[model samples]
Target: MDQAALRTLIGQLADDLGWLEQHARTQPLHVAQAAELHYAGALVRNVVGPFLEGHAALPLHVAVVGGAGAGKSTIANMLCGAVLAESNPQAGFTRHPVAYAPASGAVNWPSSLGFLGTMQRLSKPEPSSLDADVYQVRRVSEEAGQFGVLDKFLVWDCPDMTTWAATGYVPRLLEVTALADVIVFVASDERYNDEVPTQFLRLLLRSGKMVVVSLMKMREADAPAFVAHFQREVLDKMPARAVATLTVPHLTPAQVVDPCRNAPVYRVPIVNQIFVLGEPVQAARQRTVRSATSYLMSHQQHLLGVARDDLLALEGWRQRVREGQMEFDNRYRREFLTTERFRRFDEALVRLLELLELPGVGRFASLTMDVLRWPYTWTKKLFASAFARPEASSMPERQVLENGLAGWIDHLRKEAASQTGKHPLWEHVQHGFSAGLGNTIKDRFNESFRGFQLSLGDEVERTARKIYEDLEKNPLALNAIRGGKFTAEVTTILVSGGAILYSGGLALPFVAASLAMAPLSASVIQMLTEFFGSQYVDFHREQTRARQQALVAQHISTPMADWLTSWPTTGGSAYERLQSILGRFPHNLQQMEAAVQAAMM
Candidate 1:
């Protein structure tokens, strides 16, 4: 537990807590968790770290805290044995904590670095009503009879907790509270059962600070009953700690002005209680440290819950990304895969058969066959030329791909729009979707699709070339297959012509043309059917389909998926920042926690 090392660790913890506080949005748990983190950091840096470094414990802090107009300043004035703070009649008058130490400055206070967490130290005197993130230290005159009994202690007069303005300066209060070893809780007759101050008391008690409840602005006669009621309603339910409850009778301004001198009899009891709690400074500091650590340990689940909420939000974003990917893939399959004809496949088949022609001898054999069938070939060509229809116009592949991608982008945008208010992630995605995100997606998709299209021709040609290359290795089998294909063509053409002539009618021209070219068309169809049935061709076709599917996925599906998956991390997105901060804060806290525990031991 090197003091410097401990200070460095605590410093980092303070920074992490500050980050949490800044990002705490609207959730109550998130806000409370951030406050708790700040409190923990303050304790480590201001109390534990300084104590370990052998800093003086004599100047033990005693903070008087309560709701607005709860007689907090009166208690501070009484503790100092004089009117050191302004006890105004206005509610929420005290907006910042004012520290009252001995004029002699006998005890050295902890530096501002970790003293009040993020609150700045005001060098010039400022009114307690100055509502800001700051604290000011002022030394009170050291009259022999005033503050003489509590020479080694520093008393802090803190702002009211129940005021709306308190939100702006409550961190200042928590900061002073974290520095305190003892707390003098002031509650007027009206505020005794108030929810806000009671909860604050509970937090203090839970943190293990020594507390003395001064029930103020109550008649002396009703003190007993009030004390009993306060004990039953507040004290009884709180965990056992070193706590004392007393009654401060309502007083006039004159009496409050010089509480110790004018009402010496009334002030003696409160002074005695303070004396009892502040002596043996080492023991008091240890109690504070142990109490803080215990509170942190007990509330570990709460802190973790805060982190879990953040991660759950992140998970929601990831789930949306996956859904978007699925939608994209579905659209591509429906718009592209289902409608695509792959007409190039037919051309590829013919080219593959041409490659299988025998190098020299097979050509001569084929030529002799052509000469014998010259009359049939000539008749088939004449009729085919007369009846051939023009190829039908269709959508270009590029247009189809672009249309499908646009549809997918539009679908995602609509989904985001519909789900905008459902969750934080959705809201973030919705905002981004409207901000040119669709254009970015389109650009990436088009780039990938272009590359895919360029390689498609080569892919089909390669598959056909492979079939021919395999056939060339087995010339005898190739020639036999070719001879059988030729005979099948001639036989089919003759049968088709006989059928057309026997069933003659006014439709003779069209039917006759179709039958005449039946030798070439029917033979090619039969040859392909037989070749596709063979084990080798079947394997090749399967391979080609698989490769084609892979190409589609790589170019289109993969790009869309990648964009959707990574959208949350893109620059300027709220989710990206949330993810980064959430990850870093919790991990740093965990490590700091371990270091703190070891150092304490």
Candidate 2:
């Protein structure tokens, strides 16, 4: 990736993660992971981007970080060898981060690089400032720093992490922490093992910044045991990172007032640790950059952990949709498929009979067969007219379909509306149903139904055409069927005529004889019927039924089911937007890693 592309990716990744952080829910898991994502993006923007782009690291800055009243400002004063930072006794005193530049020279830290992320870098500290979006750069007085150990280093007096009041300003502290080359963790004896402070220490360690743990304000007698206890409880429990631990013994009033009088004895270990850990400035920044980048890359899934709930909800929604779709299909089968006579296939059967009528030389025989078949046709009419036909269905096919679709959507709406404690996807689905999910689905189904109708009708015609084509292809089968029909017709005519003549043309004798012959002629005709029309007609009718089922499922059920099932993740829905944003992260991390590797090379 080129510089421009890398920058764009960085900006995009940061912006996406920032959005996740902002819209995070009230659950502790969401809030925790969201905060992690925020820090990851912030580190990418503030530290790794600059490090890869060859933007110089902020001049060896040391940020003092800890919980409320953990003596962060006191530690900052020690690092500065002066009383520049306000040593407020009250907890959560520091609201915004303050940068203390060495007063001996004009020190300028670039504010345009987005290191502070829209935070105003003030010219002086605001001891009483409540704003979290801004930080200040104050020049430390020359006289306060007699010890020149940290003179070249810019120090930060950052806000606390453990207090509820520190919630808003936590990002400010994180910004300063990312900008700093070395972190001076000032954990007092009282709150060394506090959840937030210890978590902050562990985070700083993982971020790959040089850390010097300051175990401060301990009684001299208890300092050794306390330092050891803090080590076992806090630093020892952290992921393997080489961090220096030191103690700032509870000082006298005079010693507190003038920390530099004894040459700021507490500053030596911290300063020495920083120098020893961050000897080569470029290497130090590079390490921090590599670690921060690795942290982001490794924890990318955790960063997306916020969406786990949404994804599960989406799957649940899809399952319900599939169930509803099954019900829709079942309803369609019951209401429409079973009763459908598909009269078009009957027309096809008639056309097939026309195809079987051999033209030209066979016309005379066909005429004779038609005359003989009058008896059978008359009998069918007599029986059919004797009984009432089944009543025509009360509902049309389209109405059945419309009602089924409406019912499917109503099921989904009820399911969504009744669901509790699910991901926000349920709420979104409920809103979708309210906003006309039924109507939209019906519109789509109607469109598909149009195509389905065309296809189904065409299928019946094709199947009917196929039967005639098959018999036509086999001349033997065609001749056999015509011969059978002729035999049956000749038998019926001969039998009836013989019976009339044998009875001497008497009406009673003729009637009894023809009635006795009725069964035999009818049976022969039934056999001929199998070979001629009924077989092909019955087979094609069934084939058309199968074709209709397929058409309805393919064009109507499948499309509608697929569309409705995936609707939650479409059209700018919440899950749709979330996955879109989530999709960018892996690629962004890959590109950044590539760019960072190239830059290093």
Candidate 3:
């Protein structure tokens, strides 16, 4: 596939998994998987797709991500080398991100399709509103270009990931996280060791992102020990492509308000590190894309674990269907097809032998045929005649079919009841039986059985007619029969004092030999005719039984089996869609992974 098709697929798969995670009914959500799914979608939608679409990687992103009240906004302002970020005392006050582009050389920050996912871009500043899924872009100037790193950067003052409000905007947080070429992780002394922030840091590092950690609001004396502890606790235990840490002492109120002049400690090194991390903007962006997608590719199974569970449930249903089909077929063969006697074959044989008579002597030939059939006709006539009457017999085909269908349902019901709570399929089947799956199938079977009888009768008539016509239309067979009659006449002629070699004997020795061979030839012709007619009858009998089986399979068994097999997917239910979602996710995810990885290469 070309790049456009690849992009479409990647976008579609990202949407699919994201939708499944959000909507599909399934087992309990794995909290880590849920979060990772969002992050993974953010990676594909904001980073990989845009990169593959030839979006330029310039004015690289740096997100300020930390916990609530961790001085994220203050840190963002200081990083701007001036007060561009909103500094609010309310914890998690920054509900949406505010992008601070460098006034010096900030163009091509990010188009809506580039890095912003489902978020709407605001033309003007409105970071305090908690209602919209939006982010704003603002340009902040450096006095005399003191912190020139801002020239090639778009710093995002993002929302806190620790507050209750964080849940609502976590997707927005992830979008920034994936878009950034660098992460400026600022942990206030109180929030540094917290589990939520620490776990978030681990995720960022494991993606091979370049992270610069700033220990915010600490004493000059405590900075050394805290930095060492933060490294041991976070950096050492974490994974990363690059990590650099610095300490920021408690700033004066004047310094906290003014970014460039009074907050030199916070402003200088933070800028220097981000600048160094994002120096070659192209390389930095590529590294971020590779790391994020690699993380997505590696953790897909874990991310799609809930979907996998749904798939397993569907597979379990399929297995039960197969087992039920086997039971149904086995019962049919055992109870009906194995012992069923076809009376049509005997009728067809009677008709076939009647064809051996010469024209205008069918009456005499049929009588002769009746007498000959007495000696070598089917020995199973007793059994076949019993079925032919339909009054004195074993279980009929209809009863066998009804019983087989009932047994099939019973087996499925028992199986479903066995694992009642294990999956939705069982529950569905359990309820389906209660709602009359059996009766529905029986009603359909009644309709099909009527059709089956009509079709089978027609087929048998055709078979018998074909048998009768074959020998009648054959000249060789007709001539043989005529010669048999002629031989019989000749034998009588010689016995009555006449020549008998087909009624002509020139000498007495010839007449004697003809007399002996006459009876043998007549007997041989009658035996051969009976022999071949019997074989044809038996062949047709087997075919008729097979045809019966096929009718049962097609008109009865197959339709029922198909309906039962597809029961789970028929209803417009969440689990039905869940099957579809699970089916599409794995292969599409693998393709998306391969496509992005190949594009990266």
Top TM-score model: 2
Alpha-carbon shift of residue 85 in model 3 (angstroms): 2.6
Off by over 4 Å in 3: 1-7, 24-27, 104-115, 127-131, 217-242, 249-267, 345-403, 406-547, 554-556, 570-601
lDDT score, residue 175, model 1?
85
Error in Å for residue 517 of model 2:
14
Query: Where does candidate 1 stray beyond 4 Å?
Result: 1-16, 25-58, 81-83, 112-114, 117-127, 130-133, 140-149, 206-210, 236-242, 249-283, 286-317, 338-400, 420-434, 450-562
Each prediction's whole-model lDDT (CA): 0.71, 0.75, 0.74
- Candidate 2 or 3, higher lDDT? 2
In order of appearance, the predictions have TM-scores of: 0.71, 0.83, 0.72
**Which portions of model 2 miss their true places by more than 4 Å?**
26-29, 104-114, 123-125, 128-132, 141-152, 261-265, 350-394, 451-457, 469-539, 570-573
* Candidate 1 C-alpha lDDT tens digits along 118-154: 6787989998889888888878777833743458578
Q: Compared with the true structure, what per-residue lDDT tens digits does model 2 show for residues 1-601?
A: 5667767777788788787786575445587666676677678778777766677654777888888888888777777777778888888888888877766666644432455666776654566456658887777667766553456578788888877777788888878887777788888877778887777777778767778888888898998899788777777888756477888888888877866555357767776777776667777767777878788888788788888777777778788888887888888778877787667666766666666565678888676665545676677779889896885674698898888888888888788878855556777777776788777887888799899887766676677677778878998988787676666666776787787777776689667768557455754565466455767677777767676777778989888878877788799766676778877778888888888877777
lDDT for position 251 in model 2: 85
Q: In candidate 1, residue 355 scores what lDDT?
A: 53
**Model 3: per-residue Cα lDDT over 183-203, one tens digit each:** 988898887888888888888
